[model samples]
Target: MAIEHADVLRAAHLARLGIDDADATRYVGDLSRILEMVDALQGVDTEGVAPLAHPLDATQPLRADEAIEPDRREAFQACAPSVSQGYYLVPRVVE
Candidate 1:
């Protein structure tokens, strides 16, 4: 696909880029060549191949889920400056 210089300028405007006229001309040509390479890749054939996220088939070691004893809540609450109905009390921000 042939990309025009105007398209490059429009993309630069959308991206908030300030490209010099010299650079914008060069970028238009470079981007067009990149698109041609991507178009070439579309001609390749791949049959009977399973898609894979990784080349290796290894599993990570995991720890078993287990229940733990509750910690001392009363002991920790004793150090609070104010407590009401088993909850911490603070100065109200709203009326």
Candidate 2:
């Protein structure tokens, strides 16, 4: 999986990126190394290995679901220009 200079230039053009010749040369080597690393990773054996959500065995503590504040819906709705059936009314913008 070797990345060429022409490939880098084409990718840059497609992405609308402004890259010089020196930067393109550097990217060709960097991209080639990244692909080589990916190729190496693909060669690993993991036939019966199970996937894990997290590396460490830990559980997050959660608080009990309970309301701690008093309801003030009527008080807040009093400040609105229009409200109907426990909902704020808004001017229609579309037909």
Root-mean-square deviation per candidate: 12.3, 10.5
Clashing pairs in 2: none
Model 2's lDDT to the true fold?
0.93
* Residue-level lDDT for 79 in candidate 2: 100
**What TM-score does structure 2 among the candidates reach?**
0.44
Candidate 2 C-alpha lDDT tens digits along 1-95: 99999999999999999999999999999999999989996787878988778888987789899888798999999999999999899998697
lDDT for each candidate structure:
0.88, 0.93
Clash count, candidate 2:
0
Model 1, span 8-76: residue lDDT tens: 999999999999889999999899999998989667775776776777897778977987768877887
Judged by lDDT, which candidate is best?
A: 2
Pairs of residues at least 3 apart in sequence or in different chains that clash in candidate 1: none
> How well does candidate 1 match the true structure in TM-score terms?
0.44
User: What's the C-alpha lDDT at position 34 in model 2?
Assistant: 92
